[model samples]
Target: MKLNYKEDWPLYLIVLGVITMIAKEAVEVVLTPSKKMTSETNKNEWHQPSLYLDNELKGADREMVLYGENLIANTSYYFGPHGTIQPITNGMNCQNCHLQAGARAWGNNYDAVFATYPKLRDRSGKLETIASRVNDCFERSLNGKAIDTSSKEMQAIVAYITWLGHTVKKGDKPPGSGITQLPYLNRAADPGKGAVVYAEKCQTCHGNHGEGVAEGSGYGYTYPPLWGDHSYNTGAGLFRISRFAGYIKDNMPFNQASHQSPALTDEEAWDVAAFVNSQPRPVKDISHDWPDISKKPVDHPFGPYADGFSEQEHKYGPFQPIADARKVK
Candidate 1:
């Protein structure tokens, strides 16, 4: 039998308050000591991790955040290239990139978005709002058109991101917030070497051709395509070996890999990234990106660089030299 706090007013207030707090912070259940829960850098500091609860929320605000959560978790259904609400993506779910709806640690989670956003991004060299960031994903990652900032869908998404990051203090770098920075390889990673790794480790889920398995009769992907017309455009973050290598190293092969215990070694990760990136995919002109070439990452994979490095050198490794030269200047 449930404990009836019906007549116990004080107990009712206590439980209600607890529920309210739970609703606001959505990630408490799986929080570990290693996670920087309170902006602390200590390896095992104490702090609560939170993931908001939707059932406890009431009325319109609750409805909005919940809808936003749904969009993030089920992006293909609502806004995919063939989605019912709007067809603006390459049929990939947002969760394909932001694992566990942006709740999981080091899974490209949004723990830092709310805390660090409305700030300057060197890529554009402008202060970007959350909406612009979302649109960037639309234009590049999804290979589609931008959703209107004034639209309800955009508002809902922003609301969800805001809720996910509500517990984080502004400017606090929550531990394991984003993908880890993997070490750059001394020699350029080789796509030829990568093919073997992909055949051995990746072909099962991503298909022999990287076309990805379908979820149902629909176009949604069970495992997203690594490279193709339907995959992320060349302008996407994953197009860069540095970015993609770090991503796959942290999480890949379904249930096998993680940020700490990646199934692939650093070289394997880097090479496999090269192999995947070498495949033909849709292209989008990013000539206007990184308006200040001096600030561009060494692996941007495009030209007119501040450093006179070859495009091949930029795409491949030995990136530290370029990185070092930029630092000196």
Candidate 2:
């Protein structure tokens, strides 16, 4: 009442404290880790079966499984799945070109690939979207025609790749997971030995000096330039011996029906990578997202489709909390 307004101060203070407590909890709930526990678990489960099946196969069945898995894994690169265009060089799958998701020393890998998609690709000065990015590989990498952006096969391949991308944090460089160890440069692999391997396994498509063949008149290079001026820029990954070795070990050559395709040992892959890198390539600035190079998650590496983190969070963060690997069961 009129007793004293000052005497009501403590009551007001208590009310303010209650309001603050509620607001804090509400914020916590809204910003709590986007629990993707199920998504992560599914990935682990999927990989286990593939590994187990691989271990169990024998004889022709083993060969069949390897071929099938190679096809499934590299569908985008070879079959023009995922809106790819090319399909001529080896008549094989993406695994054939990429070699186990590109595990060879100078091969391409799909890991940490999220950060590079949705890129502004310059195809003969024309700006292309991510769908076009997929198509470019079809045209150039597989020597096939591109797929329609809306195709189911393209969507499936994208889904598979997106699933794989989720294993690493976005923006980080791959740690050369599939790479093999090699001797020091002083004890470097004999490029002579590498030359023999290349002629027998690589020359058909990649050409004698790794100068990829010419497709139609002025179409993309039939075989991608391995180390020459037209090949990947000096700073564009394949320059790294380890990454190149990893790619060759996993993927390579044209025919992957037999693991005997590349037929190169880890040391062999490393030597080849060394030989290739030692060759001439244009030294250029290969721009990439830098500093915050965390492993990218699957799904979109950027844009509205990405999960958990906001564009700002994805770009700069308190990154997404590492899924509790221990909690995965």
Best by TM-score: 1
Instruction: Score every model by TM-score.
Output: 0.83, 0.38
Residue by residue across 1-329, what tens digits does model 2's lDDT show?
Answer: 55455988888888999999999999878766544543453333312123343454466554544443444455534453232444333232454345454333223445545445655433224444445655555544444556767865555455444434545565564443234333333243445666666777777878777777744534344456686644554444345555565566656654452222345676666567656766776554223422222333211124342234454332222222322321341
Q: Which is the leading candidate under lDDT? A: 1
TM-score of 1: 0.83
Total backbone clashes of candidate 2, pairs 3 or more residues apart or in separate chains: 39
Lowest-sum lDDT 10-residue window in model 1: 44-53
- lDDT (0 to 1) per candidate: 0.83, 0.49
lDDT of 1 by residue, 270-296 (tens): 999999999999999898899998887
Report the alpha-carbon TM-score of model 2 versus the true structure.
Answer: 0.38
lDDT over C-alpha atoms for residue 129 of model 2: 49
Model 2 ranges off by over 4 Å: 1-186, 217-222, 257-262, 286-329
